[model samples]
Target: MIALHCDGSLTADRASYGGLIRDATGAAILAYVGKGEENSVLGMELMAILRGIMLCIQNDLRRVSIRSDSKLAVDILNGEVGCPWAMQVLKGRIISLCEQLHSKEIRHVWREMNQAADFIAAIDTGDGESIFNPSEFPLELVELIQNDADCKAYFRTSSF
Candidate 1:
């Protein structure tokens, strides 16, 4: 099984999405960051999921465990909530890709648990997408990915 962690965020006028793909042993396979085709947050989230599924399919990975920080996206895909009209087409495509997989599991994780993907998603990637091998990752990104692979916990603080 392959484990995919993905995230999406709005930056200025554009939305960016990114994530890392890991094997069952938690070793990084590759990392991706890209600008969204649409500016909607949900659109970006769904797009990230779509990209992850496509990556798995292209690599001939049959069992996928997708983790995202978007609860709404996860809920919608899992049939726990209705998909918005604007997202029906994208959602359908995602479902179709999922059907091609021998096993697919989509789950929501807290942002803290998804720091690496969140950080990658916020990167300004201009107009195109970028994919990186583990050896080519930026220092900060490499650190984040390592921490994730090591199962290190990340804590976030918010002022109320």
Candidate 2:
């Protein structure tokens, strides 16, 4: 079981990505990537989330606690909002997928708490961050984020 979370931020069109990955043991990993382009940030943000979910599916992961920063995206996945026009075709597909995956289990995290995920948006627009297991990151990288709140803060303040 794992509690997987991701966050994304977008400009008018450019989007950034970041994520938190935790295993059953509670150890975690952080990743960030971004896509710079002239697409709606909302689109990019939701794409980031889709990317994360696809990873979990590809790995045969179960008991996942997926999360995201975009309320619109979250609501859409959670069946809270009516399907948008463009989503009409996708609505059936999306809802069917949600049902297949038990997507209601997904949650929302605050933007500030989603800094790592936001950083990911800068990594690979639609491509997203490579799906890495939480156990993959070295203790040094984890410690760096744990010790340096300033460095973590830099992700927000720096130009992506």
Candidate 3:
């Protein structure tokens, strides 16, 4: 099984933020960012969702669920209708992606499940200071989970 979670936050400046949480068999395979483009925060967040879903599909993932804190993103993913003009184009993109993925199941998780991605995405590019580093987030915890050795050990004991 595979699952993904993500979040996006925008500042007053021309800056957008987004990140994703990826999990396979009780372990995370990846966690990272998608930002610095000419997109709104919502658009960036939705893009993160798209990126994660595409990754799962490319990896031949089965039974994948996507989770996110953004209600707009999740609702749009769940076949919601009637979007604003500003969002209509991307909304269409999300719908297309959903169909393309075509997994057995996909869900938008609650805020709790999406905490890690949200935390990493909180960096503010709005201010003129560049005192932040991406490497500081999730750190060894995320690395350990994504590391192949960990997944091997994990599935070795759990595989029936």
Candidate 4:
């Protein structure tokens, strides 16, 4: 099975999405980040999932288990909730792609557990989209991936 962990980030005028595809053993097969034309958070999230699905299809990786921090996106895709009208087209595209896969599982994870994808999504690569091989990962990203594989927990702190 392949594991796809995806996330999205949005600011006032920009939105982006990112994700990594891993093998059953949790080794990163490929990671991706892309800019989203839409500024909607849910739109960005769904686009991230769509990109991940496309990557799997392009690489012939099936049996996908997709994890996203967006509960709404997962629920919408799983038929557990109503999809927003604006997201219908993207939702349909994702569902159609998922049908081509041998098997699929979509689940929601907390943002802390999803830091790697979150980090990647917020990156500004000065390009429309970027793909990273394991060897090409930055140190911070490598650490995040390793921590994830080791089941290490991440905590956030802020100083006001």
- Per-model TM-score, in order, reads 0.93, 0.64, 0.65, 0.94
Q: Candidate 1, residues 1-160: lDDT per residue as tens digits? A: 8888989888678788888888988888888889887778899999888998888888898899999999999999999999989999999999999999999899999987788888878888688898878888788987887787788966678798
* Residue 12 in model 1: lDDT: 78
Question: Which candidate, 3 or 4, has the higher TM-score?
Answer: 4
- Stretches of candidate 3 off by over 4 Å are 36-39, 102-106, 123-137, 140-160
Candidate 1's C-alpha runs over 4 A off are: 156-160
Question: What residue runs in model 4 are displaced by over 4 Å at the alpha carbon?
Answer: 154-160
Per-residue CA lDDT of model 2 for 40-99, tens digit only, reads 555555655555555666566645777777778778777798656664544454345554
Two-way TM-score contest, 2 vs 3, winner: 3
Q: Write the per-residue lDDT of candidate 4 for residues 50-146, one digit (tens) a residue.
A: 9999999999998999999999999999999999899999999999999999999999998888888998898888659999999998899889889
Give the winner by lDDT: 4
Q: What RMSD does model 3 have?
A: 8.9
What's the true lDDT of residue 69 in model 3?
Answer: 71
Question: Looking at model 3, how many pairs of residues clash?
Answer: 0
Candidate order by TM-score, decreasing, is: 4, 1, 3, 2
lDDT of each: 0.87, 0.56, 0.58, 0.92
